[model samples]
Target: MTILHLALADDWTAAVDAGEYRVSTLGRTLAQEGFIHACADLEQLRGVAGRYYGEVTEPLVVLAIDEELVGCPVVREIPEGAQEAFPHIYGPLPVSAVVQVTPFRR
Candidate 1:
């Protein structure tokens, strides 16, 4: 399964520049969240972005992750009231697993 993660373009660029992608959120990481949050599909992506990042002024980037190369657990579960289950990677996210990344705006 290919999962997607919405990341700030600056964060993504910083990781690419550092040769590793460790920051899990705009301020935290897997250490704090226990998982690298991602979405199962495109529909979920839009809602997630709008709900959690609607006010973000910086550009957002959608990271397309090839689940097979993740080398870690990828679990899907719905939150308390969400209609859809989301894929979450339970470990550090390796940049190599990201097969593609594109600009996102809303």
Candidate 2:
């Protein structure tokens, strides 16, 4: 299955160079947040983007991760104040697990 993570263009570039991604969300890291947030579908991705990245003007990209290729655990859990569950990767995402990278537009 494919899961999507919204990422800053620069971060993604860094991940490409480093071989792994550790950002958990905007302005946060995997070490700080403990997991990398991901969307299960495009609709969910839209909601997350609107809520967290609405005012940001920086270039963004969507990393389409192939779950089976990810070495870490992918858990589905509801975050605080949310009615639905989101996929959370419990370790740094390896760049090799990302099947596609698409530019994001608001």
Candidate 3:
């Protein structure tokens, strides 16, 4: 059960410096949608990047999160009757939860 999140290099750096990372798309807070968005696996991650960040040219990074170190709840969400689910964090993600950070380039 590996879940990942894509973040701009600078954003991730800032999060590490601040000790927390918040969802960026919707007001940069969990209150906007109640969770921090994430992808279930590589394929799903690529799809999300293609769909929403295709035009992005800035350096990016793939954050590999260790759920137990998250310091908060991690949930998998799918629509009613849907088979595929996405991973989301119920609160801000601490830098410690991210076990690995890899450069993301298309």
Candidate 4:
């Protein structure tokens, strides 16, 4: 299965150089958030982007991650006050697990 993560272009580049991704979301680190948030589909991703990243001006990229290539655990759980379940990575995401990185348009 593939999970998608929306990342800042700079952060993605940093991760590429560092060999692993540690950011959990926009301004939060994995150590602070405990898990990296991901979306199961494009529709869900759009909702998340609109709700959380709408005001951001920085360039963003969408990371298409191959679940099988990820060494850490991927769990599907509903966040508080939310009905839909989203994929959450339990540990740092390895760059090797990312199958594709596309510039985000919206």
Candidate 5:
């Protein structure tokens, strides 16, 4: 299994096309933890920024992760070498464009 952290909707869509079960955002499901706001349009992301946190003025960024390929327990404790590649797009990311399949959580 491979967990792919995406910074854009297209990224997630591409993964789906490639035959993967992408986990909806944390906002969509409670079992899925974290916040990702990336959308087709930049404005949509900006509009929803407030819903995620208070006292916000500028647009926010969001991303999605492929949970099925990613494997269990949403959260993870990543290692150092892998950490450099997986820059946190939003909250704590489980994978990245360059990195995947970290030590599983839970």
Candidate 6:
């Protein structure tokens, strides 16, 4: 199964720049499957994450991933001072907060 990740952007422009997620050979091998990345705005991601996590909540990014890949999406949030990664989460994120969305395959 393929696992996809959705990381939220700081703003609308960031969303556009985020574009689609891609997986290289190394990434594919690491994931042990395919991967895709997507971007969504805070409000939109909030709605999706709200429904996912139950009740209304805000998330930095809403990740759409497959069941098999749920536990191992391969890619995760980059730590501070490790060189900013694309589709990075900006602003403050709560410790209790995570914005992974259910797989919405098209």
Clashes (candidate 5): 4
* TM-score winner, 1 or 6: 1
User: lDDT per model, in order?
Assistant: 0.84, 0.96, 0.82, 0.96, 0.35, 0.33
Per-residue accuracy of model 1 over 1-106 as CA lDDT, tens digit each: 7899999998899878776666666667778878888988888889888888888888899999999988889899887887778888888777888999999967
Q: For model 3, which pairs clash?
A: none
Residue 9's lDDT within candidate 4 is 97
Instruction: Report the C-alpha displacement of residue 20, candidate 3, in angstroms.
Output: 0.9
What does the lDDT read for residue 19 in candidate 2?
95
- 8-100 in candidate 5: lDDT tens per residue? 344444544655423444334212634332332224334334334345333322443444433334444332543322212233323443233
Over 4 Å off, model 1: none
Q: lDDT by residue for model 3 over 73-100, one digit each (tens)? A: 8888894654689888989998888999
In terms of TM-score, how similar is model 3 to the real structure?
0.86
After superposition, candidate 6 runs with Cα above 4 Å error: 1-33, 55-106
RMSD of each: 1.4, 0.5, 2.3, 0.5, 14.3, 14.3
Error of 6 at 82 (Å): 34
- Tens-digit lDDT track for model 4 on 1-73? 9999999999999999999999999999999999999999999899999999999999999999999988989
TM-score of each: 0.90, 0.98, 0.86, 0.98, 0.24, 0.21
lDDT of 6 at 21: 35
lDDT of 2 by residue, 8-94 (tens): 999999999999999999999999999999999999999999999998899999999999999989999999999999999999999
